[model samples]
Target chain A: MDTATVKKIAKYLHLAELEKREVPRITLQYPELSVEEAYEIQEHLVQIKLEHGHNIVGPKMGLTSQAKMKQMGVDEPIYGYVFDHMVKSGQEISLSDYIHPKVEAEIAFILGKDLEGTNVTIHQVLDATEYITPALEIIDSRYENFNFTLPDVIADNASSSGVLFGTLLQPPHKLELDLIGVTLLINGHTRDLGAGAAVLGHPAKSVAMLANMLGRRGLKLKAGQVILTGGITGAIQFEAKDTVSAKFAGIGSVDFVVKE
Target chain B: MHDLISEKAARFSAHLEQAELMGQGVEPLTSLDPQITIKEAYEVQLATIQKKLDTGRRVVGKKIGLTSIAMQKLLGVDQPDYGHLLDDMVVGNGETISFSRLLQPKVEGEIAFVLKRDLIGPNVSALDVILATDFVLPALEIVDSRVKDWQIKLQDTIADNASSGLFVLGGKPVKPTDIDLTQIGMVLYRNGEIMNTGVGAAALGNPAACVAWLANKLFEFGIILRAGEVILSGALSAAVNAEPGDHFSARLAHLGEVSVHFNPV
Candidate 1:
C-alpha cells in the first residue's frame, strides 16, 4: 500500500468529517485503489484522530453479510475505529454534524476481556464480552452522494459517524443471541425490522471478526472498549428533527432526536 | 522497558484485586514507546497475574480459549490462546454464584482435563495430551472482564490473564479413551431451555489438541502442565449470557453435566 496515498486520503476524509463537507470518491481519483490500501487509509485516519486528541474507543465491523460481500466482491468485512466525538448516546444529534445523514441499527458488544488472536470464536467473544446492547449508528459518508466502492467506503471508515447506545445491557448468557430481534422506528413509525442473525448469522460473530482482524495486525481488541457490530438492517436515510429509535428484542432500545 | 507499560500493569493489578475496572487501554502505553513489542503485552499480563499470586492465589491449571474455526477466523488466527486458571476462580457444581462478584461474565461449556501426570511441552502433541490426562469432565468457565466494557484485543486478553473469571466442574468424569475426543457432543441449556449445541471437533479438531496447544504455548514461558492440574479445553458451544435468577446447564456426551445458578445481583 502507498503510504502517501493513505495520508492524502486520510486528510481529505478527516477534514470532510470535521467541516461537514463531501468529496469525490477516492477510487475515482485513484482507480487503482485496493482493499488493503483502503484499510491503510482508515488506519491513518485513526492515527489522525488520536493525534488530534480524540481517543479510539473501540471498533465497528461493516459489510459482514454474504450479500454485501457478494455485492462488494469482497470475502471479508471492513472495520473502523469508534471515536469519542462520534457519539450522542440517548441525546439529540445535530444534523449539522454530518452531510446527508443516515442511520442503521446494530448490536454492540462491550468486552470484559481483551479479545484478539487468530483463534477467536463467537463462543470466545461471549466469554470476553461485558455486555451486549442495541445501537443506532449515524453515518454521513464523505464520498459525494454516498457513491463509492467497498475500498472507497473502507477508506471513509465505513461511513461511520455517530453512535447512540441502548441502556439495556444484557450479559450474553441470558439472551438468545442468534434470535435477537431489532426494530427501527422513525418519527413514531416503523421503518425496518431485522434480527441478530442479520449480522453474520449472529452479532457476536461480527465482533469476533473484529478481534481476528486486529489480531492479524498485531493489535488486540483492548479491554474497556466498545464495538458496534455491523448494521442489522439496511441504512435508512432521515432528516432533521426526526425522532428515531432502534429497539432490540431483549437488549432494549436506544433513541435520539435528530436535528439540524 | 517503558514506564507506561509497567505503570499500567501496576494499575491493572490494583483493579483486579478489587474486581474493579481497568482505567484505559494499553495501546497508548505501547504506542508511546515503540520499543514495546507484542512480547511486552504478555509481560504486562504476567505482572498482573503475579500480583494475584502474591496475594495467595494458587494456579490450579490453565484454559485454552477460542478453539473453534469461527472463533479462530474471527480473530484472524489459526490457533487458540491460553490463560491461567486459579484455585479461587473455580465454582462448585450446582452452587449459586453471586453475580456481583463478577464484572459482566458469560459462561462457556467445555471439557476440563484433570491430569494425573505432568505434561511439559515444546514437544507436546495430542497423543501426549491424552496420555497424561486422568479424566475429562464437563466444566463451565465464567469469563469476566475487569477492563471496563471489555474492548480488548489479543494482547489485552493475554495481559488480562486470558480473561479467566470463574469455572465449574460437572457431576460426571470420563476417561480420555472412553470417548472419541473429536466426536463428543454437547448441549447447552439456559433456564431449562436448549440454547446452543456443538461437537468436540470445534475445539481445534480434537479437544485434546487444545491441551497440546496450551502446553506448547506455555513452553515459551518455561511452564508445564503438572499432575493434578485441571485444564479447561475450549468451549464446546458458544458462551451464553449469565444473569441473576438464571439456571444454566451443559451436558457433554459421556462426560455428564454441569450446572450453575447466578444469584440476583
Candidate 2:
C-alpha cells in the first residue's frame, strides 16, 4: 500500500478504538499487504497518537512464543507502540472502553540502559534490563468478531488496550529469566499457566528482539521504558465484574477488575 | 450447533486428503465461515488425521511448523501448528519429485527425529524427549498449500493438516549425544545458490524440544507418539519457493546434507 492509504487506515483504526467499536479488517481491501507495509501503518498510528498528545510509553511484543508463532505460521515477533494511556497497575478497566476484550498474564521488563544497534543478544538485554515484574495485557481487538489477520492486528497496535503491572520487582541477576512461571486465575479459578520461556524462549529475548527490531529503523529503546513481553498463558475473554489475577511464581501477583 | 461445524470440518478433511480443491484462493475458508471456533479448528485437524489413518496411511511421526521467527513473519502465521507425518510423506534424499502432484509448493530445511520408544505426555519436558533414545537426521520439507495463494489463518492451516506436502530425509544418522542440538547450524542452497541459514535454536531452542511440545500438545486430543516414528521438527529458516527443475540442498553441521529435486509436472 502507499503512504496515504497507510496513514488513513492507521487513523481510522485509532479512531475506531477510541470510539469503542469494530471495523472490517483492512486485509479485506489490501490482501497483498506485506509485513513491512503493516509495520509502517502501525508506526504511523503511533505517530498520530503522539501528535494527539499520547506519549509513547514503550513497545509491546506479540506472537513471541514459538508455539503461538508456529500456530500462526508467522516467523517473528511483532511490536506495537504502547501509549501512556494504555499503562496501568491494579486498576479497574471499564468494558465500555473496549470491544471484545481478552486478557493474558505476562512479564514486564524495564530497561535500565539504552539498548541500541542490531543483533542485541540476550545477555545484553539482561544487562540492560533493571527490573522484572508480573504484568497483564488487556487485549481488546478492534476488528469485528475478533477476526483479523496479522496485518490487521499490527495496524490495531497488536490489540493492546490496557496494561497492569505488579508492584513487586526483582533484579535481573536475582532471578532465572527463563524459569519464572505464572498462573492466571479468573474468579478464583485457575484458567491458564505459563513460563517465562513461553515468550520466545525467555523474557529477555523479547527485550532483545524489541531493541533489534527497533534498531533496524534507526530507533532504539531508551533507558527507563517499559516493555511487556507477549502474553505467557493463553488469552481469555473477560466481561464486566470479572476479576483476573496473575500470580507470578517468583515475582508477585497483578490483578484487575472488569467494570461496566 | 457442534454438528454443523463437524459437518463442514469433515467435508474439508475429505477434500484435503483426496487432493480435491474445495475452492480457489480468492476467499479463505476461515474468512468465509464463522461457526468454526479455534477449538473446532483442532477438531478439524484431528478429523483429518483420523481420515488418513482410515485410508491405510501409517503414521510415521509428527511435524512442528513455524519454528523460526523469520519463518512466522514470512508465512504470516503468528504461532506454531502441527501435523502428522504419515509413512507416505517421507521421500528419500535426491529423489526427483513430480511437481504436478503438489499445489503451490515451497521448500525448507529441517531436522528429522527417529524415535526408539513410545512417548505420551501432558507435561513432557525436553529432557524426556532427549532420553527417548533417538538419532537425528537432516531433512528438507516440501511444503504445499491447498488453500489458494496460501492465505491461511492459524486455524485454516491446522485444519489443512499443518500445510503438509512431503519431506526428504538424508545423511548419516547422528546420536543425540553427539552434538548440542541448539548449536547445530544449516545452510539451504536452492539450485546451488544460498537461500537461507539457521540453527537448531530456531526449533524452540532445540529440535528435541519440538518433540516434547508435540507430545504435550497431542495429549490434549488423547493421542500418543508411538515408538519408531520419524518426525520432521519444523523448518530452520524461511521457506524457498519450489519450481520445476529446481534443486534444493540443505547441509547441517553435524547431520550432513539432504537434497531433493523437482521434476517437470
Candidate 3:
C-alpha cells in the first residue's frame, strides 16, 4: 500500500475509535493490502494515538488461540499495542467509550527486563517475565460488526481497546503456563472457558513470537511493560450494566461492569 | 493491657538479644511464655531490632520465613512470618564467615529482591512489588535460631527475627520482569556436593508474591518496605545444616550463583 493510502486508512480507523463509530474493513477498499502494509498502517495509527497524548503501555497479541488461528487461516498470530489510556481496573467500564465491545480472558505478562533480538525463544520470554496475572481484554473492532480480514484487523491494532488486570501476580516459572484453566463469566454465569494452551500452546510463546516480530523492526519489549498474551477463551459480547469476570485457576480473578 | 504487652516484649527482646550477643541459643520464647501472641512476638522482634539500631547497626532489609505451603502447613500457619535484616548480617559472596559467631546455623537458597521504590501497603499487589524492584539476585540465607536446638514455634521464630542470620547475595543482578521467577531452578551444594534442589515455586508459588504478601502484611504494623532494601523472599528448598568448615553454594538458574564458607573451628 502507498503511504497516502496507509495514512488514510490509519486516520479512518483512528476516527472510528475516537468517534465510537464502525467502518467497513480496510481490505474491502484495498483488497491487495499486504501484512507489511497493514503493520505500516498500525504504526501510523499508533503515531496518531501518541499525537493525541496516549502513551503506549505495551504490546498485545491476537489470534493466538488454535481455534482462532484455524478460523483466521493463519499459522501465526498478529501483534498490536495497548495504550496506557486503555488500562482500566477497579472501576466501571463506560459503554460510551466503545462502539461494540467484546471481552475475553487472558494471561498478561509483566516484564522485569528488556526482551530483544529476532531469535527470542519462549525460554527467553519466560526469563524476562517478572510475573503473570489474569487479565480481561475488551476488544472493540473498529470494523463494522467485528468483521475483518487479517490485514484489516492488524491495521486496526487487533481491536485493542481496554484492559483490566487481576490482583494476583504470580511468577511465570511457578505456573504451568499451558495448563492454566480460565472461566469467563458474564452476569455471574459462565459464558466461555479455555486454558492457557489456547494461546499458541503456551501464552509465553505468543510473547516470544511478538518479541521476534518486533525485533525485525528494531523494537523491543521494555521492562515494566504489560504484554497481554491474547485471549484464551472465546470473546463474548457485552453491553451496558453487564458484569463480566474472568477467573483463572491459581492466578486469581478479574471483573468489571459496563455502564452507559 | 498495652503496658503488659510492651513489658513482655521488652523482657523477651533483652533475653533474645543477650543470647545473640553471647553466641548461645536460649530457650524458645513460647516455652517461657505460652501466652505469647504473634502480635506480641513481632513486638519483641521490633524491640530487639531497635536495640541493634541503638548500637548503630542499620536496617538493611527484611526476610520472609516459612513461605512454602508445606512449611506453613507443618507450622499450622496460613501465612509466612517476617524478620528484620541488619546491615552487619550481610556476608559477601564467596566470602568466608566465622562459624563460632553463629549458633545452630542452617543455610537455604533464595531469591533476593532489591527494591528501587518504597512499597507501602495495605493493598500492595504482586505487580507493585515487581515495579518497585530494581532487580533480583540469587541469595543464600544462613538462618540461625537464638532458640536452643532450633525447637521453635511460629511465634518463637518470629520473635527471634525469623531466625535471621547472615545473607550472601549473588553479583549477577537481573530485573524481576526479565525471568520467570517461579521456574528458576535452584541446586544447593554443601562442600561441592548437592544438598537439595528446588524451584522458585517452592517459595509460596512465586517469590514475588511472597514479597507482596509481606508488604501488605507489614502495613498492619505501620512498616513500609523502603527502596534500597534487600528483601529475601524465602527459602526455595529445605535448609541444610551449616557446620564448621562447611562451604555452601547455591546455583540459581538465570540469576546465577552465590556462596559462603564457614571458617573451621
Candidate 4:
C-alpha cells in the first residue's frame, strides 16, 4: 500500500501485459491489498502507460453487473482507463499482441458535457451524453489463467486491453438507454446476447456511478470522452481466425477479426 | 384493373368488418382469394379501418405484429405485419371487458411508444423512432382473429388488420431516453398466476425497431405516424389464450404494470 510498493506492483503488471505473459495475482503476494491501495497501483500503472506515450482515451467500468459484484463481493463497480493506443476499429487484431484475449459486448457513451459531482444522478448522465453506440471490448487480463482477486484485477486496469466501437451513434435523449439489445457473434454464430439493463439496470447508471466515483477524486468526465459501460454479456474467449462481432439492436454492429 | 382491386378490397373489408361486429370468426381472406398479395391485404385493412373512422371512431395509433421469431415462424412468415389502432380499441387498465365483445381472444404484453412528433418515413431508422418517441408505457394487447381457428398466412393476417382487438396501457410513462427498452423484463400473469415472461428484445430485437419498421412500411401506403399517436411496438412473448373471467396483468421493469380482466359470462 506504500507508494514504492504501488509503483513496483504497477510496473510488474505493466511488464506482464507488455510481454504478453501472465503473472501471479498481486493479492497472492501482498495478501492484504486494500481497494484504495489497489486503485493507487492502478493509477501508477496508468501513469506508466502515459509515460510510454499512450493517451488516455477514457475510463471503463468493470464488475457492473449484480452477479459479477456478488461474485467479487463488491458493493460497487471498478474503473480503469482505455488508452488511445488501445482504441482499435476496423482492423485485424494479432493474437500475439495480447496474453489471452476475451471479447464482450457493451454499450458505449460519448459525453457531450462535463459531468462532475458526488451526487451525479442517472438523469445527469443521460443529459450529458452526446452519443450512444455499440462497443466490443477485448479484455486480456495479465493475471495467471485470467484468474485474479478483485484487487488484483483492479490494479491490472480492470483487465482493460482494447476496445472497438460501432459507427452508429445517436443522442442519448433519442434512445431508450436501458433497452438496447446486443448479440455477440463469433464467426457468424451467436455466442451471447444481452440488453443494456445488464449494466447496473441501465447503461447510463454505470456512467453515473463512474462520474460520482471520479468526483470523489476531484475528477470529472469531460466532453467528447468515450466511456465504455461494462459488458452486457459475459466475455467469451477468442483465438486466431475467429471473427468477433457485436450486433446492437437499434444501434449498429462492431466487429474485428483475430489473426495470428 | 385498379378498380377491380379496389372492388375486391372493399368486399373483403366489409366481410371482415361484419365478422368483427358480430363477434364471429370468419374464413381467411387468403382462403377466399389465394392471390391476395400483401399490398392488396393492406388495402383491405385500410378499407375496413376507414369504415370505423367514418363511423366516428378515430385512428389512435398503429400496431406491429408477428415481430418475434416465434410468431413469425408460427405464421409461416419471415417478416412482421401491422395494423391500425383505433380509438375504440382502447381499454382501461384493470377494467373488466365483456366476453361477448371478443371472439377467440388472446393476450400479449408489449411496450407502447407515444410519439412526440410526426414520423413520415420512407427511410425511418430505429433512431428516428426513438427520437420521435416522447415516452413508453407497458401495454397488454388482446388480439382476436377474424380468420377462423387462428389460421392465418401473412396476407390473411394483414387483411385482418394484424388481428387488432383491444389494448390497455399502463399509467406509468417513462421517457424513452430514461430506460433500456431492449432489456425491460415483462411478467404476464393470468388469473393471478404467471403465464409467460419475456424481454423487449423479443420484438424484432428492440421494440423501437418494430416502430421504425412500421413507420417505413406505412410510408409505402402514404400513411404517416402523427404526434400523440400511441404505437404498440410488438409482442414481447407469444400470445396466451384469454378465457372468460381471466385476469391478466403484465409487469414491465421500470415501466410499471398494466392489467385487464375478462368479464365472467
TM-score of chain B of each: 0.89, 0.91, 0.96, 0.96
Off by over 4 Å in 2: B1-265
Identify the leading candidate in terms of TM-score: 4
Q: Give one digit per residue, the lDDT tens place, for model 4 in B63-118.
A: 99999877787878888989999888999989999988888999998999999999
- Candidate 2 chain A worst ten-residue window by lDDT: A175-184
- The local lDDT score (0 to 100) that residue A62 gets in candidate 4 is 97
Residue-level lDDT for B148 in candidate 3 = 89
Judging by lDDT, tell me the better candidate of 2 and 4: 4
Q: Encode model 2's per-residue lDDT on A149-231: one tens digit a residue.
A: 88888888888888888998888888665545466779976566545666776689888988999899899998898899898
Q: In model 1 chain A, which range of ten residues has the least summed lDDT?
A: A189-198
Error of 4 at A127 (Å): 2.6
Which candidate gets the maximum lDDT versus the true structure? 3
Reference A-B contact fraction recovered by candidate 4: 0.06
lDDT of 3 by residue, A1-260 (tens): 67898899899999999899999998888899999999999999999999999999999999987568779899889999999999996759999999899999999999999999999999999999999998999999998899999999999999999999999899999877765656677897666655566677678989999999999999999999999999877899998999998777668889898899
Q: Looking at model 4, how many pairs of residues clash?
A: 5
**Reference-based lDDT, residue B13, model 2:** 65
Among these predictions, the greatest DockQ belongs to 4
What is the TM-score of each predicted model, taking all chains together?
0.50, 0.51, 0.52, 0.57
Whole-model lDDT, candidate 1?
A: 0.79
Instruction: Score each candidate by Cα lDDT.
Output: 0.79, 0.80, 0.88, 0.87
Residue ranges of candidate 1 with Cα displaced over 4 Å: B1-265
Residue A179, model 3, lDDT: 52
lDDT of 1 by residue, A123-190 (tens): 99999898988889887789899889988999999888889898878888887665554567798665
Give the Å error, residue B245, model 2: 34
